[model samples]
Target: MRTKAKRAGIACAISILIAGAAIGAPRDVPTGDGMYANIKTTRGEITVRLEFQKTPMTVCNFVGLAEGTLAAAGGKPFYDGLAFHRVIADFMIQGGDPAGNGSGGPGYKFPDEFDPGLRHDGPGVLSMANAGPGTNGSQFFITHKATPWLDDKHTVFGRVVQGQEVVDAVKQGDKIEKITIVREGAAAKAFKADQASFDAYLKDSGGAAAAKAKARKDADLATIAAKYPQALKTASGMRYLILKKGTGAKPVAGKTVSVNYKGMFLSGETFDASDLHGGPIDFQAGAGRIIPGWEEAVLDMQVGEKRLVVLPPELAYGERGAGGVIPPNAFLVFEMELVKIK
Candidate 1:
């Protein structure tokens, strides 16, 4: 969780690691033409326009989960009685978690589909909520207002065509009665919300390419490990090299600390730096305000120490990498110098 000290503006670039694969391109449909979901919740119905042309696989997954066509749903409507579970007053209302707590899904996950044309520019935008990149399950959220910071980090697969008031009125613990898919026109009508259809869609949209990318990334990580044979390995799969040792006090859980860091990929391409954000960034240790990798590494460092830390995807952003900078399942390398502990 890198702090957003500097906004990237409208160019929140995202790089999908599936090289040369035109993922999410609609197969026999025109853009702007897709199915709708009539979500009947405890409050009221929120009609969402599914972006099938832009994010076909995500739309398929949502439709399949709603209609019980995907095997993960056990052949029953999955959202029939699920709670909204989480809500933030000025941010968004999240739901579709079967566990009613935010950790449950339909027993499977899928890759993310991001369309540059779609954005969280205002209220009523519908997006997937996941633990990380490519971990999209059945959980979703609707914006209560513009959420520009989320752009490129989450998949924007739908938008509310009607029921803004209902979306705003939704509260935590509100149950969704059922979600009915409404198909219109030839393109939307021809689509099938079944597991096979989704599989075909995934195949057509660079599933093989994704596999190749994973192989390349794995090989690169192995090479890095071999190169840094003496690097310290943490219990959580992180590796680091202490470049400079400091004799100052180590930061604790409640202490606020500041650091200057340069973030890069395994290829040595810099993605972000503290200087880009004006100066050193600060956060309280162990507060969950930053990524697990940063939290763990910083806590082990002294005030004036510097380290070259390598974070695996699970400890960084998981399958969902950060905006156009970090790719999915990427290995993040950071040169961090702890500046102060306040």
Candidate 2:
């Protein structure tokens, strides 16, 4: 009789494990008290509570988009029919572009609203995706895991209260049927009334500023290419001059690499140096954490290799440029020495 009871208990435990695997564990509400947005997707629904007190501007902009009161994608609901264009497992899911591509936006841009109290502490974080500082638009992303690296870099507007199971199940090409604000915040209503004036302002200055920046970048790239005639060029337009040939393992994706690097502009002014930090900076190759040019440049290198890499504006910071340090369309030069690949 004892043996039969023990077997039944083991069978029950196995069934519970199977059930748990099918449905993910529950996630806590975004905040103790706040506004929430219910996002319906093909997989399921996700609820995110907006941090109105912390990031009022960001929350208001998101609310206007969700409610279809503010102009977006021809003044219609922008998120509907849009797919989660970029999905990196254990990282985040990105969408909110009407074009389903990273380049599209609401035909207008807004400045970033920064808040020190908010952060990317765990999964289900809702933050605005921008080209750089003060370039917030319609694109936003939701984290599926802890991403402290994104803190202070992007605006954190909301957190997921329910449907994290849906978030975890979301994959690339999954569609966000629509997103609706569950409880309208006061901030959203105020921004709704100011939408017209804001639109007019962006229309007058945004495009003109962008055009000027592009022209400047083009000139910079031409100057950089002429100065580094001996550097080998890749099809992606990245140029590099090998300073030292390495005999160790060739770097590939998913490998953690340690390297010492000095970043500078064409004028020879140094912006950042890892040697001063006492040791090499370690990061995962091709993780999208670093600039695209640096990633491509390091992939061709082996441990103990040293190279001078020149990156075009598009590959480095592009038209948006880095905050204060790197200008728009400015070509960047990096002196990199790969210490090891772990």
Candidate 3:
């Protein structure tokens, strides 16, 4: 398995071959032409360094919309204070839904701008969201982890330049006050220049590097999972139930979903669950909005559905467990019920 460094090196090497524009300042406000600036939110502000030189249409699509007024922007940059829409504590934070609700997009599709040069491995590395091939439109994601799978499948045209904490601070219901796009000259450069200090913080946290070994392991499992029941191993000594199986209208990638679940440790101790007054942990599937395991399991179920998922050590919390109750490396049993599939 490639180490995180190896993966990034490989990504950088590939970027050169494909001619995807690279960021000189890896951790700044993105110092590229025609990018976004003064991206204000109730939480704070940040900026984006886009790769218009490589992805003209994609950048134009975003910049064109963000630069114009709600009506002038030809629509809304992001309608009415939208939430991150999809968040996975340490993986990524995705939002910018103009519909005010999660189920909205730019309402079109374009061929992928697959630049082997760029990667989604570092913090703030932005990538486009898609339903499938040639389907990218308005939805985008900001990585909190090094997502190697998105190397060439999606168009990763930019990265955040500042206020990544502001990005991480955004909660489930947090709204995107608005997004503004400024050219790469003064305004954008100013934001991109702030990354040296921010990059210092990033270095303390291990720089743009991420837990890639985990991503690779998960990727292997993801392949196994993509095959699904066929690859589902009953194992030698396990007693588990198929709480449910989902194969309904796939939850669109940018929409929110409501689900309730009861999780128990191998020794019969309950650790984490979604049956709370806080309501369902609503988020979009496949957008790193939740754990990778959760993303894989929920894609098939329809509305008003449920499933019993018995996850092995790798799929569950793994060696880190939830502490106190669940032991490290313990398998888990979950009785998951999907309440609303919006």
Candidate 4:
């Protein structure tokens, strides 16, 4: 009886070992002829097959940011230590903000690039997240399931070719260890992911119209500036004319200030005004609650002072301008009055 019991115990142990081996079997890594992004995370590595050909600009932006080839990244990998700031089970995981919030971006915005053939049909779909049309930036999200409602709204640039499990396992605040670009085949190997490459792609892909629009905008700004030959210019490219001087103390950073303003385009057509919002709006100075132009101008003004400020695209909205009221790369003009400082 003791011998028989020993044999049965040995057999049970063998079965358990086989079961564990089956459970821990290695998953197959995907093989393809295109470029891939191996996004190494705390959970595991997720390999994504980038649709480089279909969405050239979007893929260029992603690859540039990942490899630190883009000038915007300042010669350092942008996503090495960023967190997956937004995560929802059975939905998607979003990240790539330096501020680790939904409100931040890469200090610039690009227009959307879309392909009708690409759709959010299943999980592991990688796409850009924007506030609206023409606001594509550094932030991206990977879907956990089919999010068809997002079709055409967000630019789908790639899909997870392997490690969907890792994507699903990610939680909010999970660190993205690094993203390595892998090129397969001659075509993928020859593709250059850099600012120059992106510029060339833009030129080839209907950038002439955009260039023309920018030239017109620049000429309009020059005309506006020529009219104000005495307008004070700042190192940061802001032009202002002090219309009225005040006797009250000047506002400083962290101080609450009330300001009435009329925002207009280069043509002097008003797009926004304080009267529309009931009265002068109150906000903390230098807190970034308002545009950079307003922040810079207010710091130099005393209570009851009024100024006519001209803001370049960099100081105002950059590429992604304010809603429909403002166009991309628009130069904004504001007649601002500093009412009271608290």
Q: Which candidate number has the best TM-score?
A: 1
Q: What is the per-residue lDDT of model 1 for residues 1-342, given as tens digits with 9 covering 90 to 100? A: 244623443234333422212322212222345698888887777889998888888999999999999998889999899999999998999999988888899887777677899999999999999887678899999999999877867899999887777888888888898788888789999988899999887777676557767898789778787777788888999999999998899999989999999998877888899999999998999999999999999999998999999998889987656765676778888999999999
lDDT of 4 by residue, 1-342 (tens): 889999999999999987644433334446668899989887778889999989988899999999999998999999899999999999999999989989988887777776899999999999999998678889999999999988867899999988888888888999988899989889889989999998787666567547766788779767876878898899998999999997899988999999999999888799999999999999999999989999999999988899999998989987667665687678889999999998
Task: Supply candidate 4's per-residue lDDT for 170.
Answer: 88
Cα lDDT for residue 138, model 1?
94
TM-score, prediction 4: 0.56
TM-score, cand. 2 vs. native: 0.52
The CA-based lDDT of model 1 is what? 0.85
Candidates, ranked, TM-score: 1, 4, 2, 3
Task: Please give the clash total of every predicted structure, in order.
Answer: 6, 0, 13, 0
Error of 4 at 323 (Å): 12
Worst lDDT 10-window in candidate 2: 185-194
Task: Mark the regions of model 4 whose C-alpha exceeds 4 Å error after superposition.
Answer: 1-29, 204-342
TM-scores of all candidate predictions against the true structure = 0.60, 0.52, 0.43, 0.56
Considering only N, C-alpha and C atoms within 3 Å, which residue pairs clash in candidate 4?
Answer: none
The candidate scoring highest on lDDT is 4
Misplaced by over 4 Å in model 1 are: 1-33, 206-342
